[model samples]
Target chain A: MFKDLDPLLHSQLRLAVMSLLIGLESAEFTFIKEKTNSTAGNLSVQLDKLSDAGYISVEKSFKGKKPLTTCRVTKKGLRAFEDYVTVLKQYINK
Target chain B: MESENQILSTEQSLEIITRMIRQAHGSAKRNSVYLIVWGVAIILANLGMFILIWVEYPRPYLVWLIAIPAWFATFYLSYKHRQEARVSSHLNRINSFLWYSYGVIIFTIVVFGFKINYQLNPIILLVSAVPAFVSGTIIKFRPLIFGGVLFWLFGIICFLIGGPWQYLVGAVAVATGHLVPGLLLRNKNDEQHVQGS
Candidate 1:
């Protein structure tokens, strides 16, 4: 049976973030933005959506007086990603 | 780099995954400085000790004071690297911790070994291998893995080579482990930057 694609992750920016975060233990907000080439306003919205869904966690703090925001993919997010990829493969391989 | 509204094809999603992973791997290594600095310092200390010993010079071991300058350079370059960086990866952090912590371990072994009246050449090499191998595995870099193995092999050989001559083995291991890899990584990064530009 074909598993359904994760609706939350099917979005382009969200998927991009998930792909990058999977390779890393954690990444900063700016790092994600730079890699994704997404504008601050839009990326923030997507991040909120993902964060609210329990797919990722956003931590805010200061880095030497400058505010630092870091993001990490959660365990649930990892499972969702893997399942999404597996479902994606079924489509791609056919 | 695409519109959010459009449905991505399966091939496109796969491509994104592959591309992003490659990009993550392509991020600036920042390890060239550590390798080059420590490599040069170790080589100088080893060869200087060898020469001093051969000439029957007093306080030949003081040549290791070169590390004082290396310590300074490490701090300066690290600050510079941090200033210039836009993003720092988890891999980069781990690599930094591995080498810097390994540095303290090596320094302690050398200084304390002197006080204890112990031969540290073999011991130092054995210790050096830990960081080299672990860092290599972390980055999936083969040269450093080979360098770690070289340290282990040379460490054993130091016992056979005997006395001041073990300094030669130490030098060779440093050259292989740090110097060679530093130069290669520098060149690789340079080439990558050029291609990127």
Candidate 2:
């Protein structure tokens, strides 16, 4: 039997965001937007979902009068990602 | 990408995974500024000291002061780099730690050079290899590995040369080890930038 895919990370945009965050210490909101090529409103909604799910931590601060938002995957998020990859590999191989 | 709410097949999911992971690898590119700056500085100091010593100057070591620019450049460029950085990665932290630790060790020896009173040529060269080799392996950059080899190989050779002539060997080691690899890294970063764009 195949393990279930993570619902929180199953969506295309959420998965993409998680994948990018997986390797970085932290990434700014603008960086994610550019990488994912998502509209600001859409990206913000997805980020909020991830934040609500406890899959990532978001920090809001000011950088010289500019509001900066940085996000990092939580330990819980890392575990979820790893498990997701394992299940993905099994699916791909089978 | 989520516009139509199309369901992903296994293949599409796999593709996303691969693409994102590859994107993550993009951070592997070295900043190169530090490497180039120190390489040029150390190379100049080594060659200048050797020449001064060859001419029987009272303070051949004073030539090392030429490296003052390298320190200034490091501070200025790193600050600028931090300002511009959009994201921080684990690789960046590792690189920072390795080089900063090596920097501390180098300065410590320079400070206590008088107490040791023995020739610094071999000691400095030998110690310098640790950071270069480890970083090369971590980044999988071969030029830096060769640079480390140059340091270790000629470091032992410096032992045989002895005296002021050791300065010459030090010059060669750093020229091949630091400067050459640094330039190669710079070129590599440029190529990666083109690809990324």
- Candidate 2 residue-wise lDDT at B169: 85
* Model 1 Cα lDDT, one tens digit per residue, B2-121: 656769777878887877666555433467668999999999999999999999999998998998999899899988877655555676777778877997897788768967576899
What is candidate 1's CAPRI-style docking category based on DockQ? acceptable
For model 1, the local distance difference test gives 0.81
The per-prediction i-RMS, to one decimal, reads 2.0, 1.6
Query: Lowest summed-lDDT stretch of 10 residues in model 2 chain A?
Result: A5-14
lDDT against the true structure, per candidate, is 0.81, 0.81
**Model 2 Cα displacement at B102 (Å)?**
0.5
CA RMSD, predictions in order = 3.4, 2.5
In Å, residue B144's CA in model 2 sits off its true spot by: 1.0
Question: How much is B148 displaced in model 1, in angstroms?
Answer: 2.1
| lDDT tens readout by residue for model 2, B1-197 | 57425577768777877777656554334456677788778878888887887788998778788778888988898888788788887766787788899889988888889997957789999998988887777677888889998899998998888777787788788888888887787777533421110
Clashing pairs in 1: none
Clashing pairs in 2: none
